[model samples]
Target: MTTPHTVAPSERPHPWDRDAPHAHVDLDALRHNLALLRARTAPGVRLLAAVKADAYGHGLLPVARALAAAGAEAFGVATAAEALALRGAGVPGDVLAFGPVRAGIAELVAADVALTVAQPADLEAIAAAAAGARARVHVKVDTGMGRLGLAPAEARALIAAVDRSPLADLEGVWTHLASADEPDATEPDSATHRQVAAFAALLARLERDGLRPRWAHAANSAGTLLLPEVHHDLVRPGIALYGQPASAWLARRVPDLRPVMRVDAPVTFVKRVTAGTPISYGGTWCAPRDTVVATVRLGYADGYPRSLSSQAEAGHRGRRVPVVGRVCMDQLMLDLGPDGDAELGERVDLIGGGAPTAFELAADAGSFAYELLTRIGPRVVRRYPGT
Candidate 1:
């Protein structure tokens, strides 16, 4: 059987000791978001808070604990290490490993954390590790995402093998939806319904063989909001529960979702430059008039995409200021315009209230908010306030 104990203690150095720039995560907002996710689920549906990528760069263990205390039924992570960290932190609830677990299988199964099985060898290995310790395994069917899981027929055979194994208990079957976040992007129809239909077909096949799992899920945050019909037995709420909506559907459906992180940086230097003076590398930005240029310590290295140099805005004492010039690796400059009152050491809002939302940042940077949040660098200090 898989060993129930393998994870060591957390060794991460403090992530908030940086001097350049920082991002603060509000625990109150985290709690609020967790409550919102809890409210969305039906009476018996369990909520799995996807806390992978260090809880989307907000710190995994703490975020997981906050979610659990707020009523999340489980935690979902991308790696076995993350799962172990959650387990180490004493997070109560299921911790699902979404990615490959190399040498950590024994420890993972021993800890009673659920793992996703996509390949036959993975199934065999997990079964061997679990032995008779009763480890719950979720079968991931590559319905439409094309990323993980076995094909429909292949998935059935794998499930049968897993069922026959004494080491594993078939806990759930899940599929991912790729187009759920943006259904009307190109085609005349949303592939969300198609993905859901495929998941349903796979589940139906599993049921036909008398394989009734304890859970059946296919909804990511977008799926939960855009396609409520696919809520299934469990709902995996990731970005949505963190307060940033996955898409327009989530914004419309879940109006109460609050953003949890606010990225703020101090204005290192404020200088008034003439109209013709260029700002930062390559003179990419020229002042329309004599303006106050505020140099900010935040940059692409800190998860503020360089592509947003021209489109991003920061709030200075509640006044919106546009970003000017190219965002460098360690610093960026903002235009306080011709008439400016911003001073040195003034607080600038990068991703918080009175500032642009993560949505706005994604749009400005030509990417997804999920990527933006998860890519936030470790150098940025995360301050969790209002416990």
Candidate 2:
């Protein structure tokens, strides 16, 4: 006779259950950002939403679907797997793979994803892998980034090679800008100008060699905002799509841009500690006085950086609570001061509070919001309200 085992209800998910420490995505903000991009971009300039890095850790599948529904013409990802994931998520727009495309032709071809031909070898690989699949290809010209793509002179030769390959279809020609974010980040007083000029010269050479791509794009979010002239047939809007201004230039140019993501968590336990009592691991923080500490259910494992140990804060009841002690692997302690009204299970605003922006945390961590968002771990259940 086998005894039946009883499983605890806590171990099972309820029919309508949700976990704590979630990232709430504002769909209205997403739509508004898309509209802003549409209005700012030149007429007929396509907007390609960069949904790479899991849409900057905002849930790629939902964010991609939302952006597509909000009038995005295309989507860009870093890998073939990401593009394929979007296809699986029911994103019915053009997907461009910006990462390496060596032996993963089957995934791209199966998902009808476009490959970015950066090197001559990449073009050759796509040509060989595409076979009769009708592969749409974009040639990436390395103007100033020095990352990938063929050089200005080699672009013509690459275009010639692409023209000879029956497996790949050259649908577009594009390049990336190195320092469009900082107007002075480029040298010679015209580094941005030179890159675009080289891209244009490459295109002219390609045409001279009897190769004409259907589309030509070379603008990222920074390039799109800083130099509208770089907006060719399409513009890739990555951070901008999620409401984070792509650059400082864009912040000055478009102050109305709204960020779509907000990180929020619940106060798990709140207690008072005596003065001089150290908190958290390594005893890094001591209660300056009789202090009220709120233990929030978020930690470095949730993408909240441990470097924010002594610097970060969250909004609670119209006041700011400083994150105290070391940000542990699974939890963080916040000092609520001596006199505060926040209680157990109270909602605390983390990233998108009216007080601390994700930008602030990113700056505190010596990084960018792009990295912050992309690094958010999968533990945080992403909640999309506008979806």
Candidate 3:
């Protein structure tokens, strides 16, 4: 029943006057990815789409609504503020905050946001906050992640303490996977399998003690896609929902996945440069021969990586061209090569739409695909329903 048509268009002003760089988000592709993941996920395993870090920089509320309509039973954010924001925006369904809450407990509880009792002390504080109303809680058990969550031995007692309290509801229990994307999914001795085993044992102990949350989840996009055994009641998929692969291994597994966010800009200026013409800030790249150099209004300041100096490529006129200089704060130069018919105001894809993909560009910059998408500056306008 959920579809992209249910969401309203954003009223933010776009850079329509010139060749200003903009991020075009393909909502249809997002829905497609969601359907693909849902189709593969075990039946009865509800999906909780992770929309933290502004939905991995594709924009939060927009992505949340899209996924919710696409059949996500719940949504996950990294902070209480993110959960509150979703509630404020009127996003229905459960909004679980997976990270530590820095804000007041009353605000989150009143907002109906789920809290993670990672430690024993957190249980006492949350119980105190739930004086009049129930504070939905999710107990984090550190089966192996070593970062957050209480010890397995400490998890049950804490959950018991919270359950006895009149103001809290232990709604869901979950964990993070450290190596689900490494060495493929077949290695029996892999750290991911070990962590999964530990988690299973912990879950068994909890069940034996007659302790269970309404929802039990422990699989991210990588784990959900490869290991069906780990997809208990809910599978929270983050980057994969954005239509980008969470890892190279996942990319291979889900070959039909699409890229939803595309960075594009119009040709601001095109000039015929003579041989030996130095480009951009440092004279790092010079014209090997006389060619048409096009100035693109995209740079490191706009969330493009500067590490791609003289090594990046852009799409123009149905072919690829090289980024010929050190990318600047607001602009970069592209060597259009001879016989180029690029003109001013012509739309050129900088990172998608058949150009160097965000993953390929991020790889060239010695970074991850997450960085490339989330780092895109706010100055770059975003257009939805993009081709």
Per-model TM values vs. the true structure: 0.90, 0.92, 0.94
- Give the clashing residue pairs of candidate 1, or none: 2-129, 4-110
Question: Candidate 1 on 72-148: residue-level lDDT in tens?
Answer: 88989888878887787778999888875666788888888898888888887776776568778888988778898
Q: What is the C-alpha RMSD of each candidate to the true structure, in Å?
A: 4.1, 5.4, 3.2
Over 199-267, each residue of candidate 3 has an lDDT whose tens digit, in order, gives 888788878877887788889888877888889889988888887787777778788878989988877
- lDDT of candidate 2 over 1-387, digit per residue (tens): 100111133433343224377788887888888887788787888889888888888877777778888789899999776887778666778999887588679668767888888877887677677667767888888898999887878787786777677787788888888877774633446788889888878777777767979889888877776677788889997887777765555577678778888887878888888999899999999999998888888899888999998788888887788999999887888898888656677778888854477766788888888988888876776776744
lDDT of 1: 0.79
lDDT of each: 0.79, 0.78, 0.81
Clashing pairs in 2: none
Assess the local accuracy of residue 205 in candidate 3 as a C-alpha lDDT between 0 and 100. 84
lDDT of 2 at 213: 91
Candidates ranked by lDDT? 3, 1, 2
Candidate 1: stretches off by over 4 Å: 1-20, 128-134, 184-189
